[model samples]
Target: MPITLADKLVVAISSRALFDFEEENRLFERSDAATYLQLQRERLEVPAQRGIAFSLVQKLLAFNTPQMQRVEVVILSRNDPVSGLRVFHSAEAAGIALQRGVFTQGRPPFGYLRPLGAHLFLSANADDVTEALGLGYPAAHVYTDSVQASLAHPNELRIAFDGDAVLFSDEAERIYQAEGLEAFQRHETDRHGQPLPDGPFKPLLAALHRLQQIADAVPGMRIRTALVTARSAPAHKRAIQTLMSWDIAVDEAMFLGGLSKGPFLKEFEPDFFFDDQTGHVHNAAQHVPAGHVRSGFASAMVETTATIRKHQDQG
Candidate 1:
């Protein structure tokens, strides 16, 4: 018999994304590999603090019972093997039950996502995120300074996402960017029944949906998702229709009409939130663990690499 990841919701995350390694990471940034490894070795027994994605990972792992394991979280990091010890230690201290990881030292770690069957990839390193996204994985550049995971909901995993450019294609966004609100509204209104194209996080959403299915039979664990978008009124029809079309359902949806998403996200208290726009992300990060989906048309407006936007339609 052989081990396999098929039929499981697997999340491949970075060491920095899973724990607060900023201080140690700073040491690595300023010094050589030996110095970084030595520092990690010195503090091998000391558990690291929880990073932004900690709560999310912890909750997802809870879906796995003694008899049935529905989720897997693997540490896919750039740290040398010596530095990997603290990561497992930190997970143990947090009671995360994570047992799988791939340590690439300084080499690119995105290549491992394929073999790991990753549904999502969260890394503090933007380059790895970009690479994973390029390789067609749903990857996010976790904003380390964002709001830490909320302790309000321990058993339930709360995840939020932006609609346009985050969950769905930037087609409507392109119109909104090119024309005025009226044109955008009319376009969506005309296409209310039509399903919008899938975005980068759609695959991740589908994977979460599958986990949610498992949670239904499990007693102690649950999954809550929200579509917190800036689109409001008639435009909301298309977003809803798209999810419905895909047979995916979210616990909640906020159509804020181009307003700030911070307060709404605060109320939702997600373990993590994802958005493609900078302003929206910054606002949400102030209230919840946030990640930037470095894809879509809005990202193109920021003068970033066009390659990310070119492959933006992928998940």
Candidate 2:
């Protein structure tokens, strides 16, 4: 078969995002999320091998037999220990336990393909990944979906994210955490009419927005998006305003309040869910793909995994 363009989807993930979550927390808080992850991947001298999501990304890439294949991993850091390290190294190491020859032989299905330079190709850098594909990749380029269901065929690639701290400014979150309910509500009410500043997820959102623009212009361009948030009504208003300010289109938005969000998530289904709180992530993981984003906040960083785990267990 001629290598048809319809048989593959590309998921770009940072080394840290794919690595072990337990140990990375300390570093995640001390620095920026990307910096923390990049450092973790470099210092550990190993790719992240813990989470189910990491394993799934590897499976999609290595198992090229099926029509739904994936090619993931790209180095985006400018300066770091693992900056120059091979992107495939992480994949190979993680694959060793599964199939010995898989990583070493550079298996036909999934192996280290080649380098995608910053401007030339998306390098897993949120900004770069989004910008490069804004024009639209011949392949489907999605950020937030975990199941990769969005790309049912090899053609479409999907991306997913957890709302709140991931896409919008964590400022509102900070208020909620520090000030408690009344203060948090008051602050949100005060800021109701105004849009929140772009949070860490902005770079990616901008990239998706650009892609949406192109998709709008061109026919048969397969690009999609969703905003799965824990924010409820009234609180959800800011998210809408923020996106409006940026002029980004979210194909779907789920404002899940105190309600068990997992059911809704499973129904909407995403490639991934990025949330700052483990409480939400734990439940969401059971249904759909999920990733935890450490706010790089002191309180969150200070909390031990045991504690977070315990809290989740309790919930």
Candidate 3:
């Protein structure tokens, strides 16, 4: 029988997203691929430092046990196979059990996300992330320089997500962007009973919810999710109703009503926080590990559209 990832919560991560390769990356940018490959080869025995997404990956991997493997983390990198040696070595040194990988030698690796059945794709390359999101996968551009994960919750994997353009479609956000707060509030209030459409991250959130259920049976394993949004009061009702309609619930919800999300996220101390807006992502990155979900509204939508057109042209 062939092995399958049908029942697993699979995450496809790039080498830069998983470990600290900023220096090597800078070299690759400054010099050439051959020079970068040589640098990686010289440092083959040196384990790479943990990057922004390391803690999240490490915690998720903890869900796996000898009895039953509930999670799978694969290296979906653009580095050549030769450079991949350092990546695998680093994972081993860090005690992360990563057994599968794809080294595309500078080629876009998002194509393999389908074969991997990945629930999430984290990479430092914004173009690749945008393309993956355009393809309807839950993908994010990991902020490599973002603050590291907190040690406060060792046994728990805590994740936080923004509401509009993230867990739900950017429908309300488009309204707010175009018609101002009063109109947006009125719209939400009127449609409080109707569920908002699913966002790109909705699939990833659903996958995490399933993982939470599975963790309930595994001793000492836990997953907690939070909806940290700018929606407040009347607008919050629809967001909650939408999750309820989908039969999913977040462990916590924060409707900040346009308050700066950074301080609040600092208090929550999530392993990772994801938002669609660059401003929110950068602000949250100052306090905790954060990623930008490049989908829905403004620039994200623009990028997604361009990627779709690019693919269509290729096809």
TM-score per model over all chains: 0.94, 0.53, 0.95
What TM-score should be assigned to candidate 2? 0.53
**For model 1, the run of ten residues with the poorest summed lDDT:** 302-311
Error of 2 at 70 (Å): 15
lDDT of each: 0.90, 0.50, 0.94
Write down the lDDT that model 2 would get.
0.50
TM-score of 1: 0.94
lDDT by residue (1-315, candidate 1, tens digit) is 799988789999999999999998888789887888888999999999989998888888888889988888999999888889889998998899988999998899999999998999999998888788778889999999998978988889999999887789889999998998999999999999999999888999999998887687878778999999989998999999999999999999999987789999999999999998878888888889999987888877774555567678674
- Candidate 3 structure quality by residue, lDDT tens digits, 179-254: 9999999999999999999998999999989888779767897998999999999899999999999999999999
lDDT of 3 at 177: 85
Rank the candidate models, highest TM-score first: 3, 1, 2
Error of 1 at 169 (Å): 1.1
On lDDT, the candidate that comes out on top is: 3
**Model 3 alpha-carbon drift over 4 Å, by segment:** 301-315
